[model samples]
Target: MNTNDATRATAETMPDLFALASSMEDDMHKVSDLAFLINDYLTRGDRITLEMQQALCWPASELVEVGRKLRAHSVALYAASKRPATLLNEETRP
Candidate 1:
């Protein structure tokens, strides 16, 4: 596709991309909340298994990674959206 076509396509999809990222962020928050609940439960118990701690730690770590990636993607999207139209022109780039 031509540059204009590509730009139009990107513009059209930006909202959906942002929405999906936002949804993932919301899901990550839920995961964090669940982890907190699990920790609370474990603390109230007389004994906690290593495996149970690992179970909570793994998802929480994964959520942190996912959140990092989402933030990076959001930054990229914002940067792309802010680029001057001239920069997207084929003749303008080195």
Candidate 2:
């Protein structure tokens, strides 16, 4: 695939940030005991930010959360990609 096609494929596979965070249970990536069972998060760059993290750290959490979740949710995983588009004034306004 060319770069544009590759980019689209990547975008399509990333985790749905909203969905992963709302799931209370996790698949055990490794099992020993409850304490020892490591979910995907144990690998690092894994799991969604805590809800508290999102509330206090808007843009930073929003930015990094995408990649963290992409790692955790493996079946839906996608390599992270970035696009640089300048925002118009109205789009930038909060």
Candidate 3:
């Protein structure tokens, strides 16, 4: 298939699979950390306008979904990194 057709097919089949599969751990971690930093700002009575707050608002469900995906990706990556390559091939190893 052509590039456009291939892209369309993949998107149609898996939707956001690429996003869910890619590592966003660092970015997500920064977001989580920034939340704490922002709390400090709020504690200092730094005004966050209603429009700004509205712009920053994210749904809990969406955050939960991304967090879950990121966690699963991290676990898979850790296992792949720590496990012996020999164990991946049963016939070759044993």
Candidate 4:
């Protein structure tokens, strides 16, 4: 299809795109909440044992990584929405 057709098609899918973005944002919020909880648990006055703290360290780090990835994806999605022609061209490239 030509550029106009491609752009029109992208426009038609805008609602779905927005929904997906919204879902991603919700997921990011949930991830943030979990990270906050983990941080609170790890930092709260010495109620937990050292072993428990050590066990949480890895998961906490993983959550941070996940949050970063989610944020990056969200930004990418926003960028794509702002330039549908560019996104369409990139997708169809061999």
Candidate 5:
């Protein structure tokens, strides 16, 4: 219905921030491991096959896009956290 109602509904359905942060941290570690492995392969003096190149390219691009989204989310969350609760509630009210 109204903006306030919509915001309340969304908040009701949102996941716990602590759990989400933990999961994200775990995923980032996995990504870091993947980066280390890729770096090792690149520096090991072994020729990279076309298939390996193709596989890495897709994930690298996806990672870049994911990183952009993560950065945007982090910035928005930080900004929201800095604002007063009254201000946030007023902004959401219709």
Candidate 6:
């Protein structure tokens, strides 16, 4: 690309991060975007969708595993849409 584009990119970018705990919170989105790809493609069976991959907000690989917990959420949405609720208690929620 042109030097102008390079200069603009460099000027707009944040400083390099050495550790997650110490890194600026604002860069989470960029880091999480990459983590999503790693989880979605490198992982198999019941992978998180792109929409979810973007919603975690914290933007970290450890956080991306939240997809595993979303199984109940997906089931709940499906149950809510079905003809009617057949069960009660915890079953009704999930």
Candidate 2: 10-residue stretch with minimal lDDT: 79-88
TM-score: model 4 vs. ground truth: 0.42
- Residue pairs with colliding backbones in model 6 are none
lDDT of 2: 0.39
lDDT of 3 by residue, 27-66 (tens): 4663564464444433534344343344447554444454
Candidate 5 — what's its lDDT? 0.52
**lDDT string, candidate 1, 1-94, tens digits:** 7989778867765664565466666546644645645455435443444554475564545545544665666676576466544453433346
Q: How close is candidate 6 to the true structure, as a TM-score?
A: 0.28
lDDT: worst 10-residue window of model 4: 44-53
Ranking by TM-score: 4, 5, 3, 1, 6, 2
lDDT of 6 at 39: 52
Ordered by lDDT, highest first, the candidates read 4, 1, 5, 3, 6, 2
Report lDDT per candidate: 0.55, 0.39, 0.48, 0.58, 0.52, 0.43
**What TM-score do all the candidates reach, one by one?**
0.35, 0.23, 0.37, 0.42, 0.39, 0.28
Q: What is the lDDT of residue 63 in candidate 2?
A: 32
lDDT of 5 at 8: 64
Model 3 weakest lDDT span, ten residues long: 85-94
Please list the Cα RMSD from the true structure of every candidate, rounded to 1 decimal place. Answer: 10.5, 14.4, 12.8, 8.5, 10.7, 19.7
lDDT of 6 by residue, 1-94 (tens): 5888656544433121122223334434544556645455336544445564555444445444444434444454444443222232234344
Q: Which stretches of candidate 4 lie over 4 Å from their true place?
A: 1-58
Best by lDDT: 4
- TM-score for candidate 3, please give it: 0.37
Pairs with backbone N, CA or C atoms under 3 Å apart (clashes), candidate 3 = none
Candidate 3: regions farther than 4 A off? 1-55, 86-94
Against the true structure, candidate 3 has what lDDT?
Answer: 0.48
Q: Which candidate ranks first by TM-score, i.e. highest?
A: 4
